[model samples]
Target chain A: MPTTLRDEAAIAGIGQTPYSKNSGVSELALACQAVRGAIADAGIEPREVDGLVTFLMDSSDEVEVARSVGLGDLSLLSRVAYGGGAAVPIVQQAAMAVATGVCRHVVVYRALNGRSGQRMGQGVSGDIITSDLIHWSWYMPFGMLTPASWVAMAATRYMHEYGDCADALAQVAVVTRNHAQNNPAAAFYGKPLSLEEYYNSRWICEPLRLFDCCQETDGGCALLITSPERARDLQQRPAVIRGVSQASFDGQEQMTSFYRPDMHRLPEMERAGETAYAQSGLGPADMDAAILYDAFTPEVLMQLEAFGFCGPGEGADFVRDGALAAGGRLPTNTHGGLLSEAYIHGVNGVAEAVRLIRGVSHNQPERCEHVLVSSGVGVPTGALILGRDNG
Target chain B: MLTPEQKQDLETQIRAFVGRPTGPPSVGRDLVNEPMIRQWCDAIGDANPVYLDPEAAARSVHGGIVAPPMMLQAWILEGWSMHRGHGEPRDEQQRLHKILTDAGYTGVLGTDTEQTFTRYLRPGDQVSAETVIADISEEKATGVGVGYFITTRTTFCDAKGIELGTMNFRVLKFIPKEAPQSAAANADAADAQPQKPTRIKPPLSHDNAWWWRAVAEGTLLPLQRCAQCQKLRHPPRPMCDDCGATQWDHIAASGRGALHSYTVIHHPRFPGYEFPILAALVDLPEGCRIVSNVVDCEPGALRIGMALQAFIHEDEDGFKLPLFRPAEPA
Candidate 1:
């Protein structure tokens, strides 16, 4: 609320397990492994971790993960929902806890056997996520089953309003895949996607080809958040939390907010960006890079518009000419995003945002100032702004 | 668990009935008429003029008022007799189900359906349906229980024996697990048997069950209107976001709307549905939008602001839902 969390807390460390199709372990195990890695990376003992936060969709309970990873008594245990939309909100929760003296070190994490286990792309037929069931039922019966299909409804309308966007959508996928080529941790590190291949790829849902959908990956990601004072004494250069915001706007549904007056753009994500920018006293011009979610290629275009990187319906032009690549304007998803990187929901994207701020990303831009990071669109989403620790 | 030998024997017995008819063809209790069509249109919130106005119907491709193709099965469904069990099971399909029931698989779940409409029916058409056992599967383990998938094919025809449509329905007969032993169940579970997917039933909550029940009654499409601000809201929420009024009442929709947005789904196919589904969001006259399937039109025909009408379709499992189609030209 009034820059309360702005620069109050910092991401002291980031950790992740290898991105894979199958982790060959339970989600709880994957979560604990990432948590331990984050603690060790922060140069702190497990006993120093007094707060734990994760997505409500996470299979690991806070107590179980803390107990497994040998963490001390937890003062804050929080969970956020709406799938990947909780990516930044989990950080916000940790920042709030640290700012309020509720805890010293808060670990925000996300871990899932998304591919080997419950594939998110397979739709919500048997998934008993109660919050999604009511809204999902309205579409699931008619075969609007998967997340791709849900987003395609908006993509189709976007295309209807703004001629053909195949070229623009291809730019998002191709640019991220190009960035992935430099990062060994990315799922598509060696497999560079060409514009030709993207055009040739089969349709997952019309207007969303196979290359457009994010990988259903199995992995874990975690970040350590603490006060700026403690972060300065840590082992790594901290990525200060300049601003973080999460918002659920009016006429919001899980992924099927078709009832909105305008279904093409994501109002929720726009609200998130406005609040985050206001908190940090920054605008689109201040952001040197970004880590926008690429769960589907069309959402990347919509998010570019939502965050005011470009005018409405002008995202197609904004993403052309390697604009999202390492050397171009607004170098985005430098670690390949969810599209080319492992889909650890969108937590991995947050880690990439921090890497840009720390000037350590493999595809780091020449000038890394304020970096904008977004979670899933088409839902109640969130945004974050991180900056280099000038202190 | 049955031995492989015993399982083969059961499969052989079930396979014998595949070609046999379920029973004598069942006829509709009444001829196709406008009143039934109007009731279906209102119940589902469809306002297609062709189904209601004679002038519009006469000028349209139908050349006369025609019933929604989705209502094909509704015409021949035995009303009170089937529900009350007064109509005894005396068919080959019934005997096959009895055999399965004699075994441990007593629980039944309707999985999916595939319907093909040959043509639309006009008023005065007497519809009849004849069903046959189409196929039966081997015992397989599913998320719910170990079961067998049974498929039945039904052909609907007019009084003159002209083919109207065909529906292939699938259901799973399984042994209901007394308790959920997810760990043990997880170890041997084959992909959760959406091998034949059913329409995921809507969760009936305290605030929205009344709306669903009204749709189930097959009469009106009720919208929740806030008594305080006189605002209408869909999805039946408890409090009005506009006025924060918990006090609300219902108003029947005129079944008219316009297509606001849509998608043609092609991949990650699910069971119990046809491919290239035309899923749409319809902007109703009441200022609320509804998510439903756009029927009776091709993907290329869909536009952002095309007029639409809603209809109520009751599947074989008696799950009533609202679907939309292109409105007849005014």
Candidate 2:
């Protein structure tokens, strides 16, 4: 039988560049800066790092990043695809490398000038020949080109089946922005979103208003991973990787999985969540807080239900009355998530989870020992469980 | 603003046409045949073998070649020459248009349409259509100007009087909010402004060029069938993701579908598209879905699972794109 990877590795340090719409520098510079900061935070020499991992969509090459960070040699370097869904899996890969003794210290990072350089929300164009582009050609001719539009199709059907409306979605934005107010690193730090503001925001796609979408951010986030034994000697307290998983269902197709029978649910997420819980021997009831991916508000609602945080079709009810706020049942996305914080393809959420596990988060929960963090929703997704050393 | 008496008169004139047949029954110019079917398949880029290769179609449940169900209206559409009020005006639609035009509501635009298909059309079948006035709205302020909404329902049948489908089409006839500029002013404005670039067309590749050709030929809705698995698919691809079949064929759509889900785009307006664009994912009865624009209905009025029909919208570039509109009551 295969052994669970629970508690095998630990996240020793987390570092991030200030979230901004435009970094005014190359992605490589931002990547190097974040990697150097993470190594420094880990109290490990740059040459000590042996493994590096990131998303396949990331512009910076591993060798370039390694060279800039003054790393001598690397043994394992891997890239995961499916965009933000690679977040937790990247860390999982690093942890596996450490647990298996393939590499002593591994660094995982994601860097993008999403707003300053390549805006993803802008509809696809150019001469791209790939199977994915062929799939997109079906909808693009009808102007259903953007990510928001693709998700809206599923969201509308979800609303129809669940008796939920935009009000429930608005609550998510309000809660996320409210948390952003207290976190100085958040993009919308001082400006909190009101329910009225969320409702009044212009529609980017029907059923999804402007405020429901994540801000395209130009920044970088990096995390350092090593065996729990090594992390014990690091500068900061370690956030043990209790469990991690990546999931994709049989019928999954990027963002347009509309053909599935139950349009409202994220089956892939349910699988990932199940794997994480089984590996960690922890359920939703054991979690102190969570950072559900908030690329769009509807996704947060769907994730809440899919991860067994709530009963099916009751995600809207689960999020009511500041329940996800700082003092509520599960303080979700206490750093405001991608909605109000920087969207470093969800790497920032992982860093925030580490902060919560270390009890150093600005919006720290009262009893945050076991924190759950998720990657992108509406696609192949990933999740992680992080706990303090005592836990 | 109109006087009370004029308002009453206009309302009475518009209301009188209610419940009246809109036009005389019209027959198609040509019988359904293989060439027309092939031409339509080429135009719409459908490669459903059931529409082209008889031998492969014979093995399918459909038994033989059947016209796409969505082609019900297209079969009976009067060609371009007769589209702009040709022949003697006898129907209530003509009289209503005349009244609106005389009253300075000369500007007209199609708003929406709904369609329902009862059966697939076959080659050698002769189709005919008869229309009736459904409703006319009260004068209301709109983005373009003050206008009244006019709706009509058309029923399609074959030469033997067998019902095939029905279409509910609506349009807005209104006076422009801004007065028309003089010809010289228009010319000067045109000269002053750098020539606006043409709207971006869909990128055509080997896999999708046939669909664009169909659009140019005005056959807007088409479906693809995997030659190996015989499964229907859309957003045309060269291979079947299901059975891994590289061989495929095309079929015309029934043009009758329902709004599965939709989104009204309101940000980062792209050129050639109007604002608040209603993009929809339509579920076809043929067991496939398509993403297209839902036209002629208010964004607020759009609903998931609402019945819709297909219509061919001609862009400024003369590319006929398939769009959907809300279905009318039976």
The prediction achieving the highest lDDT against the true structure is 1
Where is model 1 chain A poorest over a 10-residue stretch in terms of lDDT?
A126-135
Q: How does chain A of candidate 1 score by TM-score against the true chain A? A: 0.98
| Candidate 1 residue pairs that clash | B45-B255, B46-B310
lDDT of 1 by residue, B148-257 (tens): 89899999999999999999999887776543235433222222232234566766666767877888887446789999999988877888888899999988898899
List, residue by residue over B180-239, the lDDT tens digit for candidate 2: 445432222212222233334576678887877776676757788889998887767788
Per-candidate DockQ values are 0.38, 0.33
Model 1 score (lDDT)? 0.86
Model 1 per-residue lDDT tens digits across residues A35-73: 998899889999999999999999999999988999989
For model 2, residues A1-391, the per-residue Cα lDDT tens digits are 1267899999998888888988999999999999988999999999999999999999999999999999879999899998899999999899888888899999999999999898888867667777777667767667777888888888988898998668888889998998999999999999977777788888898788999888899999999999888999999999999999999996687898877767788999999999999999999999999999888999988999988989998899888856798999999999999999888999999999999988988898879879999988877888899988863
Cα displacement (angstroms), candidate 2, residue A36, comes to 0.8
* Predicted complex 1: DockQ: 0.38
